[model samples]
Target: MWADMAADTRIRRTGLLERYHATRNFLGLDSCVAASAKYSTEDRRPLTKDILFPALRQVIKTHPPLCVGLANESSSTAAFTRLHTIDLSRIVQFRDNDSLRDALESQLAEGFDTDADLPLWRIQVLGDNTVIFAIYHIIGDGLSTIAFHASLLRALRDVPAGDASPLVQTPNTILLSPPIEDVTSVRPSLSTIFDEVYRLFAPKYLSSDRKAWSGNPVPMGVNGSLRTNVRLMSFPAHEVTAFCTMCQTHRTTVTAAFYVLTVATLSRMLAGDPRYDAISSTVAISLRGAAGIPKDAICDYVSAHRTYPPADPRFSWPAAAHHAAKLRTQKSKARENIGMLRFLLGQYVPFFRSHLGRKRASGFVLSNLGRFDASAVEGTWNIVNTVFAQCDVVVGAAFKMNVVCDPTGALNIALTWGEHSIESDFVESFLSRFQDAFRGLLV
Candidate 1:
């Protein structure tokens, strides 16, 4: 129909944040949102392209953002153009491996060429039942990956089994929801402006008694291969429950507790290193719920809150509680980051380029996309486990820690860093100390 054709070829201007990601993409810092979905079947049959392609087709047809690719990526006037058709064979790949870990690290190193006619997303079907959905940050955020898997699982359970004759379909007529700026108001108050200004130019010594512990300086422009180091740790359902109960007992959240744990663990691990006295952490806050965006909708609805947790040698529940209060206060005035972005106007590209070879502002970034309820879907396929991760080699943190919980209350944590950003031995030691401290606290 004429309607479908209009939708297929339409182009929409990218919002401020969306354009900011586009600028990052242009610089080859290529960040992606990747998550895993493991399915179960009573019959124990191997999942094939025949079954998955149909469900994926359904997902593509339903999620309009999936049907788009970036246009004029290197320019300030960049936009998203709806592709007429995406070759399923090129976007959806299959591998006979069961290790989602290997798949995740491999996928992160591969960036999307939005200049091409294909959509800015892909899916990797690993072994029999694990599906890893990866999308460019310009189109979606971390929680967007959760919404994607949830949608795909439902489609898998509902789409009638049959031949995968038609792997691709013409773009549908549905339009993606308006960008976050259009839906919500973000006028920065005078106080917010003053606070941001102070944070930008304040003396480093005034805020801390010691040098900030941001790991390594950012590499100069897409330094070499994009390979990264990754580590995944999971807590069983019982342990997850205990961890939540422990946090509640301490009057803090799991996110705040983990932040304190990371800060304290670093302090103890690098006790005598004279180059650093404080650690800066950036926490990603999802604004979907606050912005009235649906869970299944794909959009970049995220803001950030930065905090410097107490580096007390004796890590206690009280430290975590104090950090939690700070977190609550920062989140209460969310979207200041977006408001700050507005000041950049058309300079996002140059602004990102300027960060190359500079000391990273934060040591690490933490993102927690809380529990995903698989119980809501009463269908044949069950989501057993999930993975969420990202890496930005150009201007990102020295390392990143991403957290998510599956429907069964199992906790999954991914620690990722650009290769060479930090010493391998130091990261390994930090992870070890982190795990040990986490376990010790739950006891």
Candidate 2:
């Protein structure tokens, strides 16, 4: 089946080259998502390079478009001809949960010290029951990672005995031509959008440089990192549906409500001003609408848009639905600016591109992955849980929050912080306040 799949594969060039270049030089930030599971039964198993490698190879063959690389002007459609895997044979056990966490943290800090090779993903089997999977951010976002994992797990479980053919392979033929005219002059650059957003929405107290800059430094003290203390709290799946229903009734979206709640919470906590209105946040919007991009080209095709709430204390809950409506409008106008700024930055000040995790702009980040279907792949293997982390941004300010809602209504919130700056207590307080805000909205 593998041979059959490979025989039928064809690759094509895409226009992602420029975008990839811009992202590489500017963001300096890589996004990765990981999921792991532990099995109840322990069985001594030898490393089956054949099984693992062939399976992955089949995936690559089926999804040949993922193999494209960033070239000068055009992307090269080719298979990842050079790829390697590592075998960590040494098995280490932790006596306590703290030990397990410490070991994992140490490994992540050391393992991913540099930018990842694009389109390449890794899988590690610590023992018979434990496994770890990680992927490069450039190729996939948090939602995409979940989708990839679900598909891969399904293939592993259901593929026929000798079937070697790759799964559904798509071609990478999409190309986005940069506009001939300079759009930056007419539209707001990402930085401008962020500045406007901060000015319009962030709390007045937080507006003070001192209040916004009050966190510790990197590498943090003995208390681990701020990210370590961030906990996830989820409401029943019905709650999300109810929230969406409320949004619909108000002519808004669940996403908009989330933003409002987040802004309200931050305004109250960081600035001690509940009446504070407006807060800036970065939202990942898909760019597959570009003319020539292939529908199936597996890549990071999303761009960030800075969103802000209305500067009105009365803009709470249903009233804030108007803000969501406005977001749709502003986002459309910001598209040209988004592309132009990215292009200009890629051409000139390339190094100052990272937007999220950098120390300079660690203000706040929110990624809403709407809803995903995971029923087909769930429980086939024990999936302990999943976590998402953003690359550290360098310049302005950096803080990240990721929200993923699965089909079952399970909502997972992953928050990442700069070790030197944000306090774990602050993060916990934010989460608690967010829940309160949600409840208040519902009422």
Candidate 3:
């Protein structure tokens, strides 16, 4: 629906995290993070492409990162370049899938050419009420996906009339937001640097925490698999409310409780394995709050923290409390793995290569984008469901558990894992046990 407008300008060099994600894409390890929103009009108004096309144009205009592409993709000095133009026909599409899961999986399997002349993001429309916004990991993180929907929701309700511009004319001097490093110090303390260096270079036998169990070892062959298996499970609004109340009664948050639940479940499932004495996991923490970035900003301001919890057969409140406290402290610092990335600056590609045959770093990675109140604005439209999903990476966790709450307080959980990384039977048993154990808490 939109034609190409022309202008090319280098915005800035990729940050450490940006470069790492760019390299991951270049290596075909990860594809994209996406947010899907299902909306309905309060006044029973029909949402047409005429309304959506203009709304998307406004969204693209406001979010500067949406107008960028990566340059020098093969080099350490790769930078984000403002695209010469973005053709809406190429970036946006309509799908007739009957199920949201099918549409989401389809988008997840697709990848972006970061070095191309277009922005590293696209939108897929499902039926009339749903839109999936997908972007390369280098440009935005999970929370950034939610931010896009929030902005788009506002745009959809406020689309100006008689706006028939065939092209989004981005100004030549558009200034992208400064990367996280420019806003905060990512350099580690000398002791932190030393510990990381020792941890990375030291042999496993020399380490004191060798008992921590990550899942099966990562594949090392040139043909290491990148195909992903995904499962979706959700709890209705009432159940979600009940769950939250239970969490409050236990003096823990839902995220912390899930962490403990995951660790406890793995402990039971893998108890027969003599090699595992502890369960290690990673939590993705959004740094936007700590970095003073707004929720609506479309950028990557996040970090991850690794936790090693004892593999215990029992799920207890004390463990959840401890984990919750740990997360609070981590969020306050907001520099968990960012410093490590800075230390590995130019070696991201080699760093990922070095982990080919190693045991996966963690059993699972948990990322919660928290809740979005789609009805926050009493506009003509309301967002009913919001889903956040990620494509599993080759060198990372064995599986991923992603959480996001829709407008009606329903929790949408997406379970994803790389194909062949672990036995399907193991994951199936884990899910069964997890659901059984989680229900036990609410009762």
Candidate with the greatest TM-score versus the true structure: 1
The lowest-lDDT stretch of 10 consecutive residues in candidate 3 is 1-10
Candidate 2 Cα misplacement greater than 4 A, ranges: 1-55, 65-119, 124-133, 160-230, 272-278, 290-297, 308-315, 330-334, 342-359, 377-387, 393-397
lDDT of 2 by residue, 86-115 (tens): 122211122223232333333333222122
Q: Please give the ranking of all candidate structures by TM-score, highest first, separated by commas.
A: 1, 3, 2
What are the runs in model 3 whose C-alpha is more than 4 Å off? Answer: 1-8, 42-47, 160-166, 222-224, 332-336, 376-379
Residue 358, candidate 2: Cα error in Å is 10
Select the stronger candidate by lDDT from 1 and 2.
1
lDDT of 2: 0.46
Error of 3 at 37 (Å): 1.0
Query: Per-residue lDDT tens digits of candidate 1, residues 297-340?
Result: 88888888876654555577887798788777766467667777
Model 3 per-residue lDDT tens digits across residues 1-443: 01232334777888877887888787877789988888787676555567777888888888888888877886877887776567777778777664777777777777778645778898888775788898998879998898899888888878864554446766566677777878877767777677777877799887535888877787885354767677778888888899898889888989999888898999999888888788878999988877789888888888888877888979898888888888988875557467668667488878888888987788899999888866655647788888888885577788889999998899998887777566778888988898888888878
Q: Give the Cα RMSD of candidate 2.
A: 8.4
What shift in Å separates residue 59 of candidate 1 from its native position after superposition?
1.3
